[model samples]
Target: MPPRPPVPRLAGDGKGEGTVLQVRRLRGGDAGAYQALRLAGLRLHPDAFGSSWEEEADRPLATTAEALEANYVAGCERDGALIGIAGLRRATSVKTRHRGVIWGIYVDPAARGLGVGERLIAAVIEQARGQVEDLLLTVSAHNATAISLYRRFGFEDYGLDHRSLKIGDGYVDELLMKLDLRPA
Candidate 1:
């Protein structure tokens, strides 16, 4: 098949916003782009992620492919380029099977105000609803933007994890947040 054409960035949404996004499941073939974007996030903002660029940088591409297939990962696209990702990793033990962790929520800097993060998050939430009773994530304590966005989705801060990340000379604290999906 001739390569599929790029989705025009301004063609949808009917509002001339200059960005049209398609948030969907990412498969193994998407590993390269996923890894690139993920590594960029880790390198650009070291405190935001628990993993370091050095740790993931040396892994083979196949490792990334395996991860894409193993987890519930959603990718957002604009103009045919993968721009954002979010993942939902369910608990393996039966006792904790009713919950999942929301991880790796990142949007390219260019896509920040265009709702890319929320789209990735919403897709994860949609996929997670019937599968888990609660969703949890950790955000850097100093990241007000992410905390606010998660709050808008009804996530509540449950606790603080001090010294969550030690990047260079300083420690970064993390805020533990959760969104209950249980019917109350």
Candidate 2:
């Protein structure tokens, strides 16, 4: 693949008055920032994330860097602080090569409703467009905000995976959503 394009910085809420979120491709040096934001998300919204902080904490820095390099990792930074992140991983199976999975989507509580998640998702979708026929993602059924956001981007629910995650003593259902990029 060609060198990933530099993340574009756009005007956000001027300084602290609002929120100025810059969405761009993540790099090797961003492993710590990514890890921090990711762990925060997993802690705050356990059902929204597939991986736990415990699973990621012991991971090698090289592994994190490799993920940033191999996958389409986008981050939303405000005032030089990383507050949000999303990633798109291309399917490796031969039959699923035309699809990409959207994962690790998280925005800090303080950054919600400031368009940071929207920008991050938009960047990921734009990056996935040419490389895959469709983008697939799983979201907690109870996450209305994210569901609305994905719907606004033309993603539609195809099915539900009931009892997909065993959280604590109960199970949670996940909604499977897909955004088709093929010509109509």
RMSD, one per candidate, in order:
8.2, 5.6
Runs of candidate 2 with Cα error greater than 4 angstroms are 1-18
Clashes of 1: 0
Off by over 4 Å in 1: 1-18
**Candidate whose TM-score is highest:** 1
In each prediction, how many residue pairs overlap at the backbone (N, C-alpha, C within less than 3 A)? Answer: 0, 1
TM-score of candidate 2 relative to the true fold:
0.88
Best by lDDT: 1
lDDT of 2 by residue, 80-174 (tens): 99988999999889998999999999998987767887798889988998899889999999999899888878888999999888878988899
**Could you give candidate 1's per-residue lDDT for residues 1-184 as a string of tens digits?**
2232222222234365456789899999999999999999999999999898999999999999998898889999998999999999999899999999999888999778787877887889889888998899999999998897888777889999999889989999999998887755
